[model samples]
Target: MTEEKYAGKNKPALSQSGVRWLWLAALVFLADIGIKFLVLDRIGYGWGNRIEILPFFNLLHVHNYGAAFSFLGDQAGWQRWFFTGIAVAVSLMLVFWMSKLPAREKWNNSAYALIIGGAIGNLFDRLVHGFVVDYLDFFWGSYHWPAFNLADSAICIGAVMIILDGFRSKPE
Candidate 1:
């Protein structure tokens, strides 16, 4: 039994290629920051300063000082630093996890990369502007969804990928 345990101990892994995915994360970050900059340059900031795109869509500039859907946006102001610290910690953990992931697990790594990129993007906003820039808007009738940007979309997509990966991991 002891010999059996040691027999395969030195065997190498099937794949160790998560490092390549970091580029994907970087791309996400660049895209997010770039679009945000474009929005800032074009639309600037204000409520009545929006341009109508579709009947239900408008390119508006709104700053979110809190988490998703402006969770603590109305807080006394400590939430900004709190969310920034959380993002940093989460991003570091994701990078570490991505590094340790097997290269064969592309979906897993992609999810991690997207999440890391999104986290960094928002963290940058928190550090520089003290809030996140949201532009995209959707509405039906008088009801409206909270505005969001590319980073937020990427994060949501990545979360969906995580759920799909979980579904695919079950034994066949």
Candidate 2:
């Protein structure tokens, strides 16, 4: 297929670019950071300091030195910069994609904006704090899921939206 056919016929003008959706991304970033600071101020850090909100939920403050689910959290500390780099790169790439997309492509534009916001939110934490602050916790009986923050939640939701968009039927 030709490039135009594959990319679609939007040919958005400078003002019609999906970059308009950037406000959504900014909102996500602001909300994420705001909640994070609130958690830091109100909750003591670590599992032992958690405040149970419900049988299945709690508010706890903690730090993740690595990527999602603390992928390399046990590392000596290199993971901080590594994850930061990845977040920066991904946010830039998504913004570029958004710029090329049509303003009317709300679904994809929103997804891109969400991811960018989440990435930048976490990026801000990494740059200033040297770690990502996680506060929300969920548990069931003897099993507990990894703690995460608003930034992580936004990223996951955005990613799921993108995956679902892929399964949507196209007009052809």
Question: Estimated TM-score per prediction?
Answer: 0.86, 0.94
Model 1, backbone clash pairs (residues 3+ apart or across chains), number: 0
Indicate which candidate wins on TM-score: 2
Which ten residues in a row are the worst by lDDT in model 2? 1-10
What is candidate 1's lDDT per residue for 1-172, written digit by digit as tens? 1343225453224245565677777888999999899888899687688888999998888899988899999998899999988988987887766655556567878998998888888888889999999988888987889898888888888889988886674433
- Model 1 regions lying over 4 Å from their true place: 1-15, 170-172
How much is the lDDT of residue 123 in candidate 2?
Answer: 96
Clashing pairs in 2: none
Model 2 ranges with Cα > 4 A deviation: 5-10
Candidate lDDT (C-alpha), each: 0.81, 0.89
Candidate 1 global CA lDDT score: 0.81
